[model samples]
Each structure stands twice: as C-alpha cells, then as structure tokens.
Target: MLFVTIDRKSSVSLTQQIYDQIRKSILNRDLEEGERLASSRGLSAAIGVSRNVVLEAYERLIAEGYLEVRSKSGTFVAKGSFLPAKGKTSEYEKVMPNVADRKPIIDFRGSHPAMDQFPRKKWGQLTRDICYEAPDHIFGYAEPGGIRELRVTLAKYLQRVRSVHCHPEQIMITTGATQALRLITEMLIKARTGISVEDPVTDEMRNIFFSAGAGIIPVPVDENGIIPECLPKEEGTGFVFVIPSHQFPMGGILSIQRRVQLIQYARELNNYIVEDDYDSEFTYEGAPVPSIQGLDPERVIYVGTFSKILSPALRMGFVVLPTHLIETFRRLKWFHDRHTSSIDQLVLSRFIEEGYLDRHIRKMRRIYRKRREVLETAVRASFKNAKIIGRAAGMHLVVDIPDIDFDDALAGEIEKQGVRIYPVEHFAMNKGRHTHQVVMGYGSLTPEQILQGVTQLKKFLSTRG
Candidate 1:
C-alpha cells in the first residue's frame, strides 16, 4: 500500500488529510505517475478510516488533476503531463508561504477610508430622495458630459474650496483620479513626448505612464515637496504630474512661492501641469492651501476625486480643464467612457447641494485631526527616534526608519509579527531614496488600534538590534 496516515482526533477532516498526503506523495516522486491508488474499501479497512472518507479523498484528488476516475473502475494517478519538466520553472504557480493568510495584529496599510465613519443612513436617504424626485430625463442615458446640476455644483464647490477657476461646462466627470490620469496619459503621453514625474512618486502613475510608452524624467523632491528648480528645462517635455497640496508618502505641502514657480515654469515651457489634488480636504492646521490650478487655470489640469473625501468604491472624480482644451478633453472623454453614471452624478449633486458633503467633511476633519494627534503622541512615546513626514494633511504619514533600509526582509519580519506597513521603496522610480521610510495610514484606524500598532512597531524595531 502507498504510504499514508489519518488522524481522527485532529481538526483536519479525513478527506483533507488524505488529499494532502497523496498530493505530497506525488509531488515528492514517491508515488510515480500512473501509480494506482488502492480501492476505497480496502484503503478504508487498512487505514481504519471510513469508506466514505477514502472515496471523498479520491474524488478531490481526481478534481485536482492528481488522480483520474474511470467509470466503475479503480482510481489511478494521472501521467506526469501537468508537472514541470526537469530544470524548468513556472512563474504562474510559484509557491511562496502564504503571508497574507496570517491575520495582522496592527494594520496601517494606506488609502482605505473608514466605512464605519461614513453617514450611511444620511446617504441612503439622500439617494432615495434623488430617485423620488427624478424627472423623466433621469431615467435615460445622461448627457455624455455628466449631469448638468452636478457639474455646476462641483464647479462652485471646487472654486470656493480650492480656488480653481472654471465654469461648469469645463468640468468632466470620471470614474476616479486614476482613470482621469489614465485617460489623460493616453490622450497626451504619446507622440514621443517625455513626462516629468517626481521621483519617489505614486507607483501606479509610474506604471501608467510607462505603459503609455512615455519617457519619464524623475524630478527630485525635498521636505518642501518637489523642487521646481531640479526640473529639466527641455522642450520635449509635455506633462508634469504633481501632488501639490499634500505630497503622497511624504507629507510636505508646496508653498505658495513654489506653487507660483511651478505654474510659471509650466507656462514658460508651454507644458501642461496635471495637478492631482488628492486628499487635500483633511488639513489639521491653519486655512486650506489654494490649489496650483488657481494660479493659472489655463495651464493646469486639476484632478479631484471623491474617493478620499467620501469612499473609494464610489469611483467618482472630476477634472477641471482649461477652456481651450475643453473641446479636446470632451472629444477624448466621448470616445473614452463618455460620462460617469447618471444616477451617481445626480445623487452626489444632491448631496453637495443639500450641504451633506460639507457637513460630513467638517466632522471628519475634526475627527481625523485628533486621530493624527493621538498617532503622533503614540509614535513619540514609542519610537522616539523616528521622524514623521506629511502629518499636516492626508490619510497617511511616512515614518522615517533612519539609517536602516526597510527592505523586503524587514517588511516580512514585521508582517510575521502581526503588523503591516508599506515600504516607501515600493513607490520610488529610483530605489534607495525612500529606503528608510514606511507609510502608515491612520484614516481607518482607531486611536486604540493606532496606539497598539505603533507600539508593536516600536517593539519590533527595537528588537532588530
């Protein structure tokens, strides 16, 4: 009989145990291909397990391609056809120990909004109201340019908040800022043009631009954000993407002077600036900073998303375009998606006009500001040497690990200890610059979780020596 064992007392079921043993035997080459497994009755009697257990095991083995079941005949191991040949590799099934299977004790992963914090009841009522008050036009395919009311409301909202200058007609709705960026890149990144991107920028943008076949010029960023002085003075460059309000990963706000300088550079170079006003709604101190788009609406393509302010699954965002480029953008948008969902646009429009969105944001602002303070206090009490970056605004903060590189090995070690953090190196176009940093998202985390997670991190880092 082929070697196998079963434990009746163990939590693992008999079928699962049998399946695992048989699979291992085949993988280890002990039971060569074409070997026949014993009849279920005989195996059951020999192993002192139930006949059904043996039969179920055989069924699973057959289902998984290890054993083949014949009509009213005994089960037999299949040929070595599916197995990898000697000295060959399969990247598809490259088996690593399942790290994700482990439950995290402290979760600090970024960009996730607190679903519990959102006013679900209020939103539901608003959605219901929109449906109840819908006119005949609401039931049909909306204007390819999005709902008129939403565009008008958003234009006024952005103008008041970000100081962006644009009419409702100039704004185009999108699925999200990511989609907006994708559409923009496809529409402009070709024709042998190079886009200047900030080094240690968002990883998704790097991939998006690269896939569009655009050459990238990595501009270095400092504590004050992207150094405009370091940008290449070239004519071939057509796009400059920036996170001006609160820089991603590193939380440095672009000063008014730098903002003006950036717009002046874009104007002088005759290139367009893709201002991703991502996560500017959660400022802790002082008045909100005016968006760079406010400087020169004609030169800046301002992108905003509801993902941060509201929820990500909503997939709603808009771009305020220049008057001259509105036609080009409209044409591009017409061919690409045409417009966002009519229902979502109308409902969101009502949410804005009814002042629910502002009310919600105001509440969250105070809540997040306190959470930020609590996080700071915990980190300070725990990891005294660690430096916090981008603390004034946004959902995440970068904790500088200092001197040591937070490589994959270190990340794995921390993960093993039941805490998760994103290494800053993952976001860098050029490595080694952000090696000493890790992003900690506290938007969804409570004060207790943040304290406990940071405390765990401090302990883990302290144990490194």
Candidate 2:
C-alpha cells in the first residue's frame, strides 16, 4: 500500500492534498503508465480520510488525465503526462533573457571559466563530509563577514598566492566579486565622489559605480593598464576600481612603476582602490603579478572569487578589507544581506584546508594555458591581418582588427554566420576608441571549439570583404 500523510494544520484541505500528490506521482512517473491506484475505500482507510474525500480526489485526478478510470478496474495512470525536467530557473534570468533554447554555436564572450574541468566529484565528497561532520550551529545564520574558518583559510591562501597582505579578521565572504564591488561602491564610495574607472572598461563594472550614484572619471588604458599619470588630480575622487593582474576586454597587467604611481596618487588624494583579482590564478606567463594590496595594504581592498577557479554557480567570493573599512563593510553587508550560506562557507573551508582548492587551481592553470595557446595559434593562422594583445596572463586576450568598424551590425552579421563574437567596444564606456578590437575568451571553450570559432570568424571576415 502506498503511504500518504495528511497535514491537519495546513491551510490546504485533505482532498486537495491527496489529489495533488497523486497527480504529482503520475506526472513524475512514480505511478507509471497503466499502474493502478488504490480504490477510493482503500485510499480513504489508509489516509484516515472519508471515502467521499478520496472519491473527490480521484475524480479530479481522472478529469485532469493524470488518472484514468477503467470500466471494471480501479484508477490507473494515463499513458502520457507532462513533467517539467528539473523545473529550475536561474536568478540571472531575471536580469537577462532565457537564452537556453538558442545557445550560440561557439561563445567567445568573456568572463567565463573552464567549467568542464571543475572537480565536481571531489567537491561533492567534501560537501557530504562537511554535512555530516560540521557542528549543528554551522547550519544557522552566520556572521555577515562569513564563517571564521573559511575567512582564515582564505587569508592564508591569498597571502601565499597573490602576495596580499591581510589578516583573517578583515576578510568577508561575498556572493562574488560583483557584490564585493557593490558594497564598496555604496558604502566607502558614496555618490559624492568621482569614481576613477578605466576607459573601454566592462559595462558591468561601470554600472556598479553609476548605480551607486557616483560619476565616472575615465582613465585611459594601454598595454600596461590604466595610465597612472592620466589619473585625475582633482579632488572628490573617492575610489578607483581596477583589474590590474589582467585587465578585462583589453587584458593587460599594470607595470610595477604604474602600480607605485597609482598608489602614490591614491595616497596623496586620500582615496581607496578596489583590486578585483578575479582571474590571477590562471596566469600562464611565469609567476603572476603580485597584488597591489601587497604594496599598500592600508589603502587597497583586495577582492577575489572562486567563480573562475571553481564554479560560477558556487557564488563564493571574498574581499580582504583595509583595517579602517572592515567594520563598515561588514555592517553594510549585514544590512544588504545578513550573510552568504553558512554551510557553503563551511564546506569551502574544509575544501581549502584539505588542499583541494590549491590542487584544483594548479590543475586548471595548466588546462587554461593549453586552451590559450590553442586559441592564440588558431587566431594567428586564420586572421593574419589582426593583432593580438594582452596574452601575458588571463583567460582572454584582445584581437585588434584594424582598418574596419567592428560595430553592432558587423557582430550581428557574424552571428548570422553561426559564430558568436563581441567587439571590444561593446564593453567600453568610451566605445568608439576600441571599435577595431574584439575580445576572444577561451576559458569556457574546448580546443576544438576554439579552432572552430576562429575559423568561422575568419570565414566571415574574408567573405564579408
């Protein structure tokens, strides 16, 4: 006999609950096609409900095609029924469209990681271990600054790899780098200040500061990153958001001299700098650049993310705040979101402490290097006229296609050829300047896909001309 429990306290009536459960079973194939259900009297006795209630529930299920009543036989599931697979929707869909149906043949879009390479098996094992071993308190609401163990582990990891100067007390776990930036934009960088941003910067980063009520001051970037000499000398500049390890869209590292120059300018102006070290772990050109935070820990708020190293769906990122900003940042996070998931933080703590995070990053570094090399070689072979920049370190590099307009129309036409690529100017606030450049991100693509995407790109460029 199938078991069915009734919630007497629920607002839902017993008849409706019975109907719902039966219908759900039919659709889920738990009651397969032609599987007979219990008779009304039997169901009523089993559920301790009136026979009339069971009759009504069966009648409803039968009327909906979830159950079919035979002439002499009792109820049975219909031959065909509807069931939504997984029935899940992403929070990102609220901001973007439902593009699942029309996935691009080869996506060259930026800011993605090699998701296929993620160690989901090891992560699953670690998660299960934490679920059984962690204290009961870890399942409840936690400190807005994140679980202490994760923060401690992150502090040690950042210091070892990025050369960031930070104590565990100053680290706050966030959903990702965006949340970290959003907090800094709203709290430390109020609307009254000028936000010095890189020209041809990503739209998402630009929007964060703009939404926080700050005016953007565009600083020009070259192969070496934001020109420190170009930084505004005017007062009221509160913060500078930079991806110095490997810039976005442009993909360049800030030189040591420029790092010093920018730090000195911030010191003189009494401002803050938010260093988004989002992809420093994938650096292939020798040792990665030491973080600017190491240069001036008191002035730089170092932010990093597992989205690139682990999985984007994990939504785990952290910021190492300056001593003066730690309290204020934590308070702001409390008001915004009490905290990130405590269980996730706990599991991540164990993952890092057990050396999985380090091992995984090391493995990915090699994989990403191979992907980058494949992309670089394919692009060079296919587009001889184009120039590649910012290949020193990062998941992506810029391909400058001179003497042509890489505008929206060109992009649309390229898409019509079944190749999805974005012009670098598409991400820039100062758009016209980078019109000839396009960003090719290889992190999320396989070597075959990388070659295929560039081949399609070459076809369109050659034929279009």
Candidate 3:
C-alpha cells in the first residue's frame, strides 16, 4: 500500500500533483521496483481525489515508464525504475571549501577604472534612445566583425587620438581585450610558433598565450619597455606582443627609435607585432604617444579597449587586423560566439559619434592624474628610500623599495592589515628580479584612501624591521 497526500489549495492540478508524487516516490526508491500499486478507484478514495484524476496520473506514470500495468492486475513499479542515489546535496555542500566574505580594503591592485564615476545617466539615456531609434534589424545577429556604425566611429576615433591607421572593415569588436587576445592567439599560434612577449608582462596576457598552447619567448623589459635587441631573432616567432604606450607593472613608454626597430625586426622576420594600447590616454606628462600600428599598419595588430577608460563591466574592446587577416578573423569570430551584444554596440557607436566618449576620457584623465599624484606623494612621504619607476603615465606606478623582497609571505601580511598591494614580482615571467618593487594603483581610490593605504603600508613594513 502507498500513502499519498493531496493539497486542495495548491495551484497545481490534482492530476499533476498525484502524478508528481508517484514519480518522485519511485525515483527515490520509496516505492520499490515491482511493488504492486493500488487500483485507481481505491487510490482516489484514499487520497480524496476523483477517480478520473487518479486514472490520468497513473496513465502518465505508465507512459513515462515509472509504472507498468499487468493485464488483469493493477499497476506495479516498473522494472529498472530504481536509481542509485547520490548523497544528500546538503551533505556534499558541507564538505565544499568555504570562501570567506571579502572585507573592505584599500586595494592598490591596478588596471581598474573609477566605476563610481561612470556617467550612468548619460549612458542610460543613450541606451534608451538607441533602442527606440534603431531599426528592428539592430536587435538581430550582428556581423562577426561587429556593427558597421561602431567600427566606423572607432576607426575615426583611433586614427585621430592614437594615430592608428585602419579602415573600418579591418576592425573586429570583441567581448574585451582579453577575448581579442584569445581569438588572435588562436588564429595565429601554429605548431612550433611562439609568442614573443615582454618579460614582466601582465600575468593575464601571459596566461592567455599559455592557455592557447603557444610557447612564450620572454624578452626582458626595463624602464624603457621591451628591449628590441633582446627579442628572439629566430623565424619560428609568430608575433611580438607589447604594451608600448605604457608598459604594465614597469610603466615604460617604448621610444620611437625602439618602435621603428621593432617594426623593422618584424618586417625582416615576416612576423607581425601585436600592440596593446591599453590606458595610453591617461598620460599626465605630455601628449599621448602615437600607436606603432600607424608606423606600419600592415605589420602590426592594434588592440584597444574601453575597460580602462570607461568600466570593465562594459567588456568592450576591438582589434585592428592587417588587411590580409581580416577574412580569417571574421570566420573565427563568427564561430566563437556569433558576435557581441548588437544593441550595446549600437549604443556605444552613438556615444562615440556624439563625442561623449572623448569628453568622458578627458574628465577621467584629470581625475586619474590627481589620484596618481596623491599616491606618489604618499609613497614618497612614507617611504624614505622609495624610488618611483616608469613614466608619469597610466593608472598604476611601480615603486622600487631597496632591500625589501615583497614575496608572498610579506604580501599576505600586508593584506592582514586591511590593505592590499600588488608586488611587481607577481606579474613577472622571470621571477626574483622584481622582488624589491611593488605596483601601486590609485585610479579607483580617493585621495584619503591613497594616503591611508600608504600609511598602513609604512606601519606594516616598519614592524618587519
């Protein structure tokens, strides 16, 4: 005999309720295989449901193989109906590792924009306006290369601001620079070909290449960016990856002389150059440097993103490929994700066309410059032996503190003090060389937070002495 209950007040139909109960019981093995079940007429009376409701429930269970009818006899639990049970979900969760709640800290880990300062009102209005004004086709699947309006606007914007020479047809929009790098790596990395990258490159970029099964040839970087002469002269090199405008962690701008040498080297080797012009617009000392792509657009793949200038949440970035690689990239992009969000692309196009992007960058440049100044001042005042490395550009600066090895142990101790700082060695492909340096980011921090973070760092370091 099976004991079943029915709820008269439930929105679920009586027939469905009965069907679900029996199915669940069989699956749970509470109603064992080959066990005889009561007749529909008897169950209706026992559960206070109509006989027809019970009949329908049993019929569904029979059709689903949970119950079977034996000619003259009543329904019985089907053979092979028993499923081995996994342990309770709660039991499994009890053994899962627990991640502690993140505490508020003065985070100096850079590459983040001031998200609070995002022009939400203007962006919201643009999104609404674009949705209403755009054609119905705007919501459909976009071209793999991206919508035409955005590519055109970005082409003009890049040409004017960064001196990148490219036609709109060559631009490919991606989820972010990260994706752009991934796709490019996938398309370029052949068997026995390796990527030549800066030594102390961002760990994220290094990992992207590593994930693609491409070998990494680390060219040592200094205060003047990647040493052109140090780059591998072999022919198996696929391309040279660089952050010339503002080298990450080290913060060096590649000189025009080295830029030309890099282009000549690529030309000689028949390989290409991948220029990542991230956060180059926030220069505090002088005008932004012209992109190396402009020097030899045919040999350089220029990648840029709005994450550093706008917000990472946008996940908007583009890559300018050589004319020869455009078709292949489009095919790769089409199969990758079928293209980025079409409506977002359209809204971003209008934002750039109407000069909102330029205005926003200009506003952010001033804010980041002031924050960088605060960080520089605080570090100088707090650490008497600290020497700032790199140019006075980008959101983060590297400070060389002699005799201090900012290893994992020291970094963890600093974090315990309610502050977070990134060690330069953390980003190094060749370790131990940058142990005395730390990268300090102030883009997302206020003046007070920067000062307090520096003070905390000073106190923590003094205790170790």
Candidate 4:
C-alpha cells in the first residue's frame, strides 16, 4: 500500500500522478494481486491529499482493470492483476549505439536501390514535358487499373524480356509490391487460406499476409528455391507467393523443372500463384530466367515493380492478373485509392519509351556485379568462418556468420564500429534454418564503402573473441 504525494502547483493533476505511482508500484510487484487497497479517506489523509483526489485515482485504476471494487467489500487489486513491464525495450536497447561513437558507416538494408546512378536530368525533363502537354482529362480520375499507356508499356516490356503474358487491360498499377499484395489479399482472401511462403523470405510480406488473417504456412527453399513438395496437402490454399527470380535476401533461382512442378501444384489445388519478379531486371547470369507466369497464365499473377531499377520514391509497381481475376482486381483498385498517380505514370511511360530505363539497368548491373565481388572478397579476407550465399544475382547476398549468435547484441557491436548488417532471424516467422546468417545489401554501397564497412565488421567481431 505505497502512496505518493502530489503537489497541486504541478502541471499534472493530483489524481493522474497518484494513478501513475500506484500503477508503477503494481507493475514493480510492490503491490501484488488480490491485495486490498487502503480506503480513500485513509489514503488521502496519509498522502496529504483530498478524498476526492484519492477517489478519482482509484476509479481510474479500476477502469483500467488493475483494481476491482465490490458494493461493500471495498477496493482490492484485481484477480490476475500482476503487470509486466513492456519487454521490447531490452531488444531495441541492445541495438542502440551513440551515432557519434562511430564514424560514417555504409548501410546494407535490403530492397534499397542505387539512387546515385538514377538519371535525374532526363527524368526532370520528361516530367516537365508531361506537365506541359497534359490534358485536363489526365488530371481527373482515370481508370483505377492504371494509365493505359503505362499498362501497355508494362505489358510489352514484360512479354518481350521476361516472358510474362498479359494484355494492358489486365495490368493493375500499384504504389509498390507491398500495396499490390495488400489489394490482392483484401479482394481475393476472405477467411484463412493456407498461404504458402518461402522460408527465409522477406519479413515485410509475412507481416502483410499475417495481418490480413491468412494462416501462413512456411515452405522450405533448397538450392533451387521454394520446394514445391513442402506445401501442405491442404484443400483451401488460396495462393503461393514466390520470388522465384533471385529469391529475396537469398539468391536462389528456381530451376525450370521446379518451376513447372510449382505451376502444376498450384493448378491441382485450384490456387493462384503470385510471381514477384522483384529485382529480376539486374540478373547478371545466363540469359535472365523466364517468368513462371509464361508457363500457366491462367494460374499465375505476375507482379513487377520499377522500385529496384529506378527508385522506390517513384512508388510504381504493377500486377498482371489472369483473365478470370482482372475484373476483381480492377474493382479492388477502384475502392482502394481510385488509382496510382497519373503524373508519375505518364513520366515513367516516357522514361521506358525513350530507352533510359533499359540503359540505366544495364549500367547498374555491371556496377553491382563489381560491388558484390568486392564484398565477397573482403568477407573471405576478414572472416574465416563466414559463408556467402546468393551472389549470382540481385543487389544483396546472405552471409552465414558462423560461431556467432548474430542476435541484437552482436548487431549493435558491429553497428557501434560503423558497419550495418541485417539479422536474417528477424525475417523468420516459423523460425527457418538460417539463424546465424545476416542479409547484406550492396546496391547503394560503393566499392570503397563495402571494403571499409567489411573491415570494421571484422574488427567488431575480433572484439567478441
């Protein structure tokens, strides 16, 4: 029965102060569950406060489920009243380092594009041209599917390069793949669909699917990507979302046979397949892998985005729905936000038409390849136990840092020395196999920065010894 005195001159009211003090004591275990509270008059006299203040404070505690009162038995700590301190502070605190304690560091956050290489001059010119030539109708609410020109361009671009089959009318442009996913889940998914996702996949997508109330089932990925055999033998599976071309955070491309198996499995379950061609444009290996959407357009929904090739700030991504779902997606897009920005769509159409997007991706592929090489070489030189994966394509790679927990505390120490790496464990939902690995992004980092950041990372690890 700890009582705190409150000053009337203070900004906070006396009742609030009393309520907070009592709550803290309860949380700290000084006041245990089912303990009787002091009478309001007694508490007021003991703490030099009015009975009204004590009553108000106790009422608040009662309303908050921390206390209970009976008609004549008086107030007592509620049943199951034990309170626990918010525990996530320890998790976040383990990673908190004084920014001034470290030098300027390079970052390796995944999904980041190299903004330093974007053609700003050309983009500004095109934006100006679109605005100058814009008609009044262009500014009004257009089709929620997307601007006809951008959709047509995407349709052609995907078919020619990636082998995705779809017409312009079937394409639905979204803010990004995240929104594209949200809109699809909202429209197509009702109650729990057995949503199958790759193990060691992007945490963002997992969260989105889970938040939509889809029961997520983790399917393992081997050297050839998400193993089709691992999918649950369930009847109600609505879809399987895959990043078959350079799987996110890990660079495994699905073999042609596995891709066929996946399509066949989807057909058997009567489930749709979502092919996220996320960063397929920059694959440096043998001719870029053909999109799985080409195998069975009726069962595959092809999602493509300009975020990796251009910049995320552009917020341009699209989904090429099969014929059956096209109208449903259009209605979903219409109700979601009317449509994506008309101005940005117009500018992107010109960017693609004039060959800047293609040229930019070509140049970036070379630069990123060299950067990836630099990172791999440095990791081998600095750390004896680190095993690198997914270097054949994409802007990032996964490094298995053996003999270290690679948890939040270790991540903080590396960050303190001015090097950044993402914990692969944070991305796991059902806790996949890669607990000791961290995903490293090389897209935005320069060759020099990669070398320096790796050196700092080694120094940080040596201290752990």
lDDT values for all models: 0.83, 0.85, 0.91, 0.85
**Preferred candidate (lDDT higher): 1 or 4:** 4
Clashing pairs in 1: 251-390
By lDDT, rank the candidates, best first.
Answer: 3, 4, 2, 1
True-vs-predicted CA distance for residue 65, candidate 4, Å: 39
lDDT of 2 by residue, 97-145 (tens): 5577565678887868988888889888888988999899888888999
Q: For model 3, what is the error of residue 444's alpha carbon versus the real structure, in angstroms, after optimal superposition?
A: 2.1
What is the per-residue lDDT of model 1 for residues 360-404, given as tens digits with 9 covering 90 to 100? 989888878777788888877776677888747877888885766
What does candidate 3's lDDT look like per residue over 1-465, in tens digits?
477899899999999899888888898899999999999999999888789999999999999899999998879999998787975678668777556856678999777889889989999999999888999998888898899999999999999999999999999999999999998998888745699999898899998999988999989988778899999877898899999999997999999999999999999999899999999999999899999999999999999998998889988999999999999899988898889899889889988999998999899888998999889888999888999999988899999999798877888989989899999888887888999999989888998999999999999899887
Give me the displacement of residue 245 in model 4, in angstroms.
0.4
Off by over 4 Å in 2: 1-104
Q: Write the per-residue lDDT of candidate 4 for residues 1-465, one digit (tens) a residue.
A: 675867778999888999998988887878988888899998999889889999999999999999999789888888776767675768667798767766776798876888998889999999999999989899999888899999898888888899988888889999888889888777657754668888878888988888877878888786689888888877777789899999976789999999999988988878888889989888777778999999999998888888888899888999989898888888888887899999999999989888888898889989988988998999988888889887378899888877877776777778777777888877765564777889899899989889988887887788767
C-alpha root-mean-square deviation, each candidate:
7.4, 8.3, 4.3, 10.1
The TM-scores, one per candidate, come to 0.78, 0.81, 0.83, 0.77
Better of 1 and 2 by TM-score: 2
2 versus 3: better TM-score goes to:
3
Q: Single out the weakest 10-residue window by summed lDDT for candidate 3.
A: 95-104
